[model samples]
Target: QQQVKQSPQSLIVQKGGISIINCAYENTAFDYFPWYQQFPGKGPALLIAIRPDVSEKKEGRFTISFNKSAKQFSLHIMDSQPGDSATYFCAASMSSGYSTLTFGKGTMLLVSP
Candidate 1:
């Protein structure tokens, strides 16, 4: 079984600031790194992802980075708002197999005005 380790159990960011969460994996076979966002009452949804071949991927205010050599990845939320506050999770899985994601402990982010 593979594992993903995440840092900073919780975080607080001011509005328009940047919030970053990091994760490290020990499985070299994992090829996909994704970040999931979960709001107060909703289930987690994919926010952004990066492949081992790419160094980074960005969408809107979200960015995901992949470091194949280090077997690590990260998520960066830019211009963060209170609405963006959520429980973020870092996950890894093999693209070819069933999407059984190995998730991290999750990071609770609070964006304050």
Candidate 2:
């Protein structure tokens, strides 16, 4: 079974609008939650991350909201720009594991100009 589940396979937003993507994971052992942004023909890069210790995190226009008890998390992009159009992925990982990331099916965000 997929460890993580993501919704809204695709999304479109107007310029300066907020884009939201959500995810839920099955494994309670997961200690870290991270969001990645990937552009076509390029690799996914880390966008934002949150630990179970915190409820939320933000960097620039990207924000990650995490819920420990619910085993769920979401990404919110504020004031999204056209350049922000890309695939976003939510992932879970544990330091004790193989050190590999378990990613949710990605969300494709299209930010219109």
State the lDDT at 77 in candidate 1.
Answer: 90
Residue lDDT tens for model 2, 1-113: 99999988999999999999999999888898889999999999988898889998989988888888898999999999999999999999996748789999999999999
Q: Which ten residues in a row have the lowest lDDT in candidate 2?
A: 92-101
lDDT: which candidate is best? 2
- In order of appearance, the predictions have TM-scores of 0.95, 0.96
Cα shift from native, residue 91, model 2 (Å): 0.6
* TM-score of candidate 1 against the unseen true structure: 0.95
Model 1 lDDT tens row, 1-113:
53899988999999999999999999888888888899888999988888898898989989887788888888999999999989999998999958789999999999999
**Runs in model 1 lying further than 4 Å from the true structure:** none
In order, the Cα lDDT scores of the candidates are 0.90, 0.92
